[model samples]
Target: MHADILLRGGDIVDGTGAPRRRGDVAITDDRITATGDLSDWTAGRDIDCTGRIVAPGFIDPHVHHDEIVLTDPGMDCMLSQGVTTIINGNCGFSIAPLTATGPLPQPLGMILSNDAPRFATYAAYRDRLRADPPAVNTACLIGHGTLRINEVANLDRPADRDEIAVMARALDAALSEGGIGLSTGPFYPPARASTTGELTEMARVAQAHGKLYVTHMRDEGDRVIEALDETFQIGRDACCGVHVSHHKCAGLANHGLSETTLAMIDRAMQTQDVGLDTTPWTASSTMLNSGRHRQASRVIVADSTPHPEMAGRDLADIAAGWGTDIDTAMERLLPATGIFFIMDEGDVRRILAYEHTIICSDGIARGSHPHPRVWGTFPRVLGHYVRDAGVFDLETAIRRMTSMPADRFGLRDRGRIAEGTYADAVIFDAATIREANDYAHPTRPAEGIDLVFVNGRESWRSGVHSGARAGVVL
Candidate 1:
C-alpha cells in the first residue's frame, strides 16, 4: 500500500514501556497506517531510520506556553527537544478567561508578561489557537487563580460563597469548552487565600465534567506533607483525579523528603487517582518576588523589566553591584523572573525516578534567560538520566514522556506508535541524544534529534524547523 511517509528499519520503542523491536512505521496523512514488516509498502517520502531509535514524540505534561503558543508559534524551544505536545495553563494561571486588561498580578505576570493579550473566554483562546496553530499540540487546564481574577474582587481573602459559585460556573464552562482539567496554585499570592473548601468547590466542577485536578501544591518545602494532605483531601472530596505539578522538595531542610512525600502519594493512590510530574533539574524558576529565594542557595535573574541588563546575572551579584541587599534588589526588579537553586539534587533524582512520575519541562517560555528545561528537558532525560545516570531504561523513559502523560491527560491517540494513532514521532541516535543548552546558554537546540514529525508532517529536521504548523488544540 502507498503511504504518505515510510520510516524504515528502526528500533521502535512504541511508547508503551515495552521492549524495543526492529520494525518499520508507515504514516498516511496524520495517522499511523501500519507498523511491523512493511517491506512492500511504498511511500511518497521514504527515510532511513536505521540504527536510530524511532519513538513516539515527547509530550511535556507541564509548561507555561499559554501566550507564546500564540505569539511565537514556531515553538522552537519545544520542537528542538522532540516535544510534539504540551499541557498548558499550569500553576493556576492561564491567558484566557481574562477580562481585566491592565497589569497582571504577581506570578501570573511572571510568566504571562503584562502585555499579553486577554481572551474573555476559554473558547476564544482555543479558537485563536485553531486559527493560528503552533508547532505542537496543546491541552489546557482552567486556572483557579484566573477564576479568582475574574470573579473575586478581593485578592487578600478567601472567595465569598457568591464568588465561589461564579468561579465554579466559569470553570464548568471552560471545561466544557475543551479545558482538560482544573489547575490550582495556592502557592502563588493570588490563590494563597483560597481555602480547602473553595478549592474543593472548583475541583467539583472539574470532577463533574470528568476532568482532573492538577496542582502546584500550597507548599513544597517544610509544609509539603500538609500540602499533599490538602491535595488528597480535595481530590477525595471532589472525586477526581489529582496531578501534582513539578513534585519537589525545596529548601535544604526538606532535602530527602521525597521519600516521605512519594510514600504519601503511593498510599493515597491506593484509594485515589493520583499522578505527578517533575523536571530533571534541581533548580526551580518563578517570579523573583515568590520568596523562594529564601530557600535558594543561589538565584539568577532570568528577566527584569526595570533592569534589562541584569538578565542571566546572579541575584547576589546584582544586589552587591547595586550596593543593596538581595531583597531590595529583588524588589526593584518587579514583575521579573528568577531561577532559584532551592531543590536538592538527590530529591530531583528521586522524583524523576518515581514510578508514577511523568517528565515535564514546567518551562516558562519567556525571559532573556529562561530555564534550560525549555530546550533541555526531554533530551536531558534521554541522554543524562537514561544513558549516563541510569535513572531508567530507554523504553521506560520514553513511556514516561509519551504514553504515561497521554493516558493521564486523556490524549489517547497521540502518544502511541500503534496503528491508527496520530503520527507524532521522533528519530534520534540514542547514544548521542543529549541537551546542548545549560544555564549559560539556555536557548541552544538539542543535539541528535535528527527528525521530528507531528501529525505526519515533518515539523523539524536536522536542527532546522520545517515551518509546519500542523498542531491543534487537543
Candidate 2:
C-alpha cells in the first residue's frame, strides 16, 4: 500500500478514552487513510514516532481567540500546546453582526479589545477567516451580547418585544452563515440586564436550527444554584443542549461548591443534555469588574488600559503606589483586565475529573500578562493532573480534551485517529509533556510536543511553527 505520509511505531491513544495500542497511522492528502500494522506501506514522507503518544490534536471547547486569529494567523500559542481546534466567540462575545464601522460596545470590546474588526454580519467574519485562515480549525458561536449591542439601543435595560424579535431574526441569519450555536455571558454588565424571556427567545432560535446553547451563567459564586436552575430552564424551554462555560464556584466563601454544582448538573443531565468546561487554573481573567474584584482574595492586573506600565503588577500594590484604596485604584484603572484568584484547587480537580466536563483554556488571548492557562491548559492537564497527581489516566484526560469536545460541538470528522477522519493529530513525549508558562511569564509555550498536523499539513514540528495556514473555518 502507498500513502502520502506515514507515522510509524507510535503508541496511539486514539482520543476515545480506551487503552493505548501500538499502531501506525497512514495519511493521504488531508485524511487519515488507515491506521494499524502498515509495515509494508510505502509513503512519500515518514515520521518515526517511537516512544510517543500520537493522538488527535487537542480541541479547546471554550476560548476567546476570535480576534487574535486575525492578527496572529499562525496561532503559535495554541499550536505549541497541541491545540489544533478551538471554539471561539465564547462568553457572549463575538466580532460579528456589526452593522457599522465603529468601536465595539463596552462589554464586547472589553475582551476583544478596542481594535477588533468590524463586520456587518457573521458571514463577513467567516469570509475573513477563509481568506486568511489560522493554523487551527475554528468553530464560532453567535454571541448573545454581540446581538444585543447591535440591536438594542440601551443595554442598561431588557430589550422590549420588538427588539427581541429583531435579535431573533439576526440570530437566524448568523446561524445560516455557518455559526454553530449560541453563547451568552449574562454575568457581564451589558448582558446582566437581559431577562430570562430575552434569552429563551434566542435559545429557541438556536434550537429551531438544531444548534446548541452555551452560557457564562449569571453567577458562579454564592447564587450558582439559582444560575444553574435558570440555565436548565432555558435548555428545557429551547429544547437545546446547554454548555456551562468555565464552570467554577468563585470566591473563598463559595469554595468546595463544585460538589453541589456538579451534582446539580448530573441530575439535570438525566433529563436534558448538559455539559461543562473548565480551565486548569485557580485564577480567572477577564475585564475587570468591581463587584467580582471585591469578592476576590487577591487580584493581579493583567492589563491596565490607562496605565500600561501596571500590566503585571498586583492590584493592591498598584493601589499603594497611587496612595489610594483598592477600590479607588480599581476604579481609576477602569476598562482594564485582571486575574481574580478566587477558586479552590480541590474544586478545579473535582470538576475536571467529571465525565461530562471538557477541558478549555477560557484564556483571554490578549493583554500583556495573560493567564498562563492560555499557553498551559492542555499540557497542564496531561502533565500535572494525569501524570503527577494521579487524578486520572492519560487516556481519560486526552478524551476530555479531544473526542469529548468534538462530539459535543458537532465537529465532523475530527477528534479521532480513524480512517477517513481529518489529519489533525499530535505526537508528543508523554514523559516530558508539561506546561512551562506561569502567571509571571504567561506567554511561554509548552515542552515535549514534537509534531502537529492540521489538514495534512505540518503546522508545527520540534517546537517550531511551520507557517502553514492550512486550517479550515468550520
Candidate 3:
C-alpha cells in the first residue's frame, strides 16, 4: 500500500507494556494505516529508524500550560522531549470561564502570569485553540479553583450553597464544552478553604458528564493520608474517577510515605475509580508565596515578578544577599515561583515504579527559569530512571507515559502505534536518550529525541522543531 510516510525497521514498543519487536509503521494521513513487515509499502517519505525505538509519543497528563500553548504555539520544549500530547489545567488552575477582573490573585496569577489571555467560557477557549493550534495535542480539565474564583465572592472560606450551585453550573457548562474532567487544588490558597462537600458537589457535575475528578489534594505533607482519604471519599460520593495530580510526599518529615499512599490508592481502587500521575524529579515547583518552601530542605527561586533577576538563584543565597531571612526574602520576591527540594529520591523511584502510576511533568510552562521538568521530564525517565537506574523496563516506562494516560484521560485513539490509531509517535535511540537540562540550565531541549510526530505530521526532528502545528484540541 502507498502511505504518506513510513517508519522503517525500528523496535516498536507500542505503548501497551508489550515487549519491543523490530517492525515498520506506515502512516496514511493522520492515522497509522499499517504496522509490522511493511517493507514493500511505497511511501512519499521514508524514515530510517534502524537503531532507534519507536513508541507512542509521550503524554504529559498533568501540566499548567493553559496559556503557554497559545503564547508559544511551537511548544518546542515539550516536542523535543517526545511529548506529542499534553493535558493541561492541572493543579486547579485554568484560564477560562473567567469573569473575575483585576489582578488574578496569587496562585492563579502564577499560572496565567501577567499577560496570558482569559476566556469568558470554555467554548471560547476551545475555539481559540482550534483557530491557532499548538505543536502538541491539548486536552483540558475545568478547574475548581477557577470556578470558585468566578462564583465565590470570598476566598477565605468554603463556598456557600449558592456559590457551590453557581460553580456547578459553570463546571457543567465547561464539561459540556469538552472539558475532559474537573480538577481541584485544595492545596492552593484559592481553594484551600473548600470543603470536601463542596468538592464532591462539583465532582458530581463531572461525574454526570462521565468525566474524571482530578485533584492535587488538600495536602501532600503532614496531612497527606487524611487528604487521600478525603480524595477517595469525594470520588465515592461523586461517583467519578479520581486522579491525583503529581502525587508526592512533600516534606522531609514525610519521606518514604509513597509506600503507604500507594497502598491506600490500591485499596481505594478496589471500591472506586482511582488513578494518579507523578513527575520524575524530586523537586517540586510552585508559587513561592504558597508556603511550601517551609517544608522544603532547600529552595530555589524559579521566577520572581518583583525581582525578575532572581530566577535561577538559590533562595538561601538570595536571602543572604538581601541580609535577611528566607521568609523575608521569599516575601520580597512575591508573585514568584520556587522549586522546593523536599521529596526523597526513594519515594520518587517507588512512585515512578508503581505499576499504575502514569508519568507527568506537572510542568508550569512559564517563568524565566521554569522547572527543568518542562523541557526534560520524558527524557529523564527514559535515560535516568529506565536505562540507568533500572526503575522499570523500557516497555513499562513507555506504557506509563502513553497508554496509561490516554486510557485514564479517555483519549481512545491517540496513545498507541497500531492500525487505525492516530499516528503520534516518537523515535529515539534508547542508549542516548537523556535529559539535557537541569536546574542549572533549565530550558535546554532534550538530547536524543530523533523524531516526533503529531497526527502523522513531523513536529520535531533531530533536536529541532519541524514547525508543524498539526496538533488539535483533543
Candidate 4:
C-alpha cells in the first residue's frame, strides 16, 4: 500500500539486454516492489527521473578494495560511479587469511596500506565485515598468493606435496566461510613459481564447493597462447568455471593479439564455462615490475617508496635525472607502482565489444597517482564507448556493466530492475554522462550520475555522500 521511494517517469533498462521501456519503479524498504505505471502509487519520497535512464547499479568484478573497505567505509570513488557492488581480493592480493607475524609480500603490500587490520582466518575477516559493512556491497575471492604467503615461506620454489595439502585446506575453509572462488596472478613474483599441478589441485577444492577459478594468467604477451592453453587446462582439470581478469594483449609486439586470445577464449568456452572482465582503457597500471616496464612504451611513476615526490613523473625522465638507465632508476625506487602504456586501442575496443565480456574497473584504490580507471571506468564505458563511439547500444552496455557481472559472480537478486529484486539502481542523464578523470587528475568523480541507490537507500546524490552506510557484505 505504501512505497518508501518512487522513481517516476524514466526509461527503465532492466539490465537483461532487454529493450528499454517507459516506467516507474516503486521501492519498499530494500527490495523493488513494483514497476511500470506507478502514477497512483503513494510513497514517502518521489525522485523525478524525467528524461533520464534508470538501470541496475553497476557491478565491478575486478577490484582491489580489500583493505580500503575497512579503512574508508565511504567508498566514495566507486559509489560516485554508480558501482553498488565490487568483487575485491583480485590479482592474488587479498588482505586476509594470513597471520600478522611476517612481512607482507610484494604486490600485496603495494595494494594494502601499511596499517591495515590483519585477520588470522578468512571467517574472522568476513565476520568483521558483516558487523561494519562499507558503503558498497563486497564479494571476495581467496587469492592463491595469500595461501602461498601463509603456507609456504619460500618464493623461489614450488610448493611441495605437504604444502599443497595445507594450501588446499586453507582454501576449502575460506570457501566455506563465503569466498566466491579462487584467483591467482601467476605473472606476479609471489606466485610465479607455483606449478600447474599446485594450482589445479587448489582449484579442485574450489570446484568441489561450486566456486569459480579466475586468473590473471601466466603471461599476456609473447607466450599468451601458451597461457591461454594453461588457463583452459586448469578449468577443465578442476571442473569449474574460469574467468580471465583484465583481459588484454600487452606490448607493441602483441598489439592486435586480443583477436587471437578472444578466439581462444571462445573455443575454450565451448568445452568449459569461461568468461572475462576488462577495463575500458588502453593503458594498464600495476606494481613496478621490470618485465612490465620493459615492454611499455611509456611508464609513469604512480607511487614510489624511496623517492616520495616522484608520484606523477615519467620513469624515463627520472632515469635521465639520475644519469642512469630506467632499470637502475626503478631499482632505486624499490617498492613502487606505475601506469604502463602498453595495450592497443583497437584491442581494448574489440574486447569491450565482446558479448561475454563483463565490465570491471580492476581499479586500485591506493596511491596519490592511482590509475584513472579507478574513478572513470564505468562512465568511460557509457560515454566514450557506448554513447560516443557507438561500440554498442546503451541497453547492451548496461547489460555488460550490470547483469553480466552479477551473473558471473552469482549475485542472483541484485542486477535486474523487477519486483522481488534488490533495489540497487542508478539514475542518470544518458546524454550528459561522461568521465572527468584523467591520468593527471585521477581522483575526480564522474559527471551526470545524478543519484545512486544501494539496497533502497540513497547512497550518493548530486555530488555528495548522504552519510548513509547501508551496504552489506554478500
Q: Number of clashing residue pairs in every model?
A: 0, 0, 0, 0
Model 3 scores what on Cα lDDT? 0.92
Model 2 agreement with the true structure over 275-348: per-residue lDDT tens digits:
88998889998877637787788899988778888988899999999999988998898778889999999999
User: In candidate 2, residue 254 scores what lDDT?
Assistant: 92
Which candidate do you rate higher for TM-score, 2 or 3? 3
Q: After superposition, how far is residue 16 of candidate 2 from its true place, in Å?
A: 0.9
Compute each candidate's TM-score over C-alphas: 0.99, 0.98, 0.99, 0.99
List candidate 1 segments past 4 Å from native: none
Judged by lDDT, which candidate is best? Answer: 1
Considering only N, C-alpha and C atoms within 3 Å, which residue pairs clash in candidate 3? none
Deviation from native of the Cα of residue 136 in model 3, angstroms: 0.7
Structural RMSD, model 1: 0.7
lDDT of 1 by residue, 159-243 (tens): 9999999898889889999999999999998999999999999999989988999999999998999999999999999998999
Candidate 4 regions exceeding 4 Å error are none
- What TM-score number comes out for model 4? 0.99
Error of 4 at 86 (Å): 0.4
State the weakest 10-residue window (summed lDDT) of model 3.
110-119
- Per-residue error for 271 in candidate 2, Å, reads 0.7
